[model samples]
Target: MTKTVQLLQEQFRHLRMTEVANELPVLLRNAEKMSWTYQEILQEILTYELKRREEKNVEKRLKWARFPYYKTLNEFNIEEQAALSTRQLNQLRELNWLDQQYNIILLGPPGAGKTFLAIGLGIDAIQRGYKVVFSTMGELVQLLKTEEYIQKSKVQLKRLREADLVIIDDLMYMAMDQREANLFFYLINHLYEQSSIIITSNKGPEQWVELMGDQGITTAILDRLLHRVEVIQLNENDSWRLKHRSTIFN
Candidate 1:
């Protein structure tokens, strides 16, 4: 109702406050300020809103949902994902595969969270705007083998040539027959030196050569993959998806 109070409110509406002490208390009357403590009101009304707006502009640089759990990277014990030493955590965090010039492999057995870790990397790359293709070994081989062998299949090969990262999960389950082996070699050769691969397999790198056979092709694939690679071996025992017999029987 006071003319001075009304004028003060109207004039200050256009001026955004840099500091609260100077601008705030004057704008809100002493009676209105009585509802709560001054510091609580000031932080909520001013600082919180401003910080939220600033974060919106840089949201893309932030990590994805899976990335938060990575803060707890562990190499031993699996209440959730075991406890990873700082050195191991740093390697996974750097995600050299995202660099596109270096490949990486997560070597482990069934239920060792190998696939989980591989997926985490794929999500991290996706958050950074890199395209990632994720597929199980059998599925990928079967899909690629579907079409009769033809030179034209190189169209699909072009896709691999352009991918930034290719995640092949469950790769050690079956021996590769001639057709599947050839298909695998072609894709690996095409992606060689151009894209990075993130593979999760039950077998270690040494075991893969004999399984894939044809040393010439295997050697080429191995050279590119191992040339610049981070091999993460999870030594945890089979722990995931275990059910308590008591609960199950009951």
Candidate 2:
């Protein structure tokens, strides 16, 4: 065992356990018996430390403060949902999109991976060091209902407009009433040119009017969102849900 390894392992031992100091000599012998070079051993320790720091950072980001929670991409956990083709994923990679100011609409039936894909994209953006806000339509409306503003409702509007990537999950789940529809329009208009938006909805563009129950508001929202966005229509698979394999965590 090298003197440096002995010293470092002893230090780690003292920090971990009192009797750990005695185990360091044996630990170093095993590490040496593996024929690891000094550089390789140092790199292994560094890698472990780096991974610890990364896990902490991921935890912080998952907290509600660093990234405000409307919903969680991690909660969606659609690791087996094969919605996109390899060609499309390659195109998305080549484009490096999600950074650009473009709207993305995922239109499909329930359990068709719309919300899963949208949350996946949001997770991707967060890992890539971009700010993101994810909220469902019902949750967003409830927020608006509770927040009372005397002058103008600018704070929420500003957050929506300034976010690097905003995700609105379950877009047309409930038909927005008069006031909610107006507020929704205000948000869509504000985010039109400034930032990117991703929306997951069961209703397609053609069925939006019926879902919203207002022709004017539906047209206004769709005109802005669809103008610069690409609509991905997910095919309805009858047995896809049953056949999908989900991993159970310990």
User: Which candidate should be chosen as best, given lDDT against the real structure?
Assistant: 2
**Highest TM-score against the true fold, candidate:** 2
Instruction: Tell me each candidate's TM-score.
Output: 0.60, 0.64
lDDT of each: 0.63, 0.67
Residue-by-residue lDDT tens digits, candidate 2, 1-250:
6788678767876665333344456545656899888887666555655565666555554442233333444444334445667567455433356656778888777777676666666666666656667777887787676557622334553555667778888877788788888877887788787778888887788888876778989899888987888788776663334455586855
| TM value for model 2 | 0.64
Clashing pairs in 2: none
Q: Model 2: runs farther than 4 Å from truth?
A: 1-58, 65-83, 93-95, 149-161, 245-250
Across 14-121, the per-residue lDDT of candidate 1 in tens digits comes to 454333324444436542766657785665557644654445422432321212233222332345444446566566657664675788788776777777677666
Deviation in Å, model 1, residue 103 alpha carbon = 1.0
For candidate 2, the per-residue lDDT at 172 reads: 77
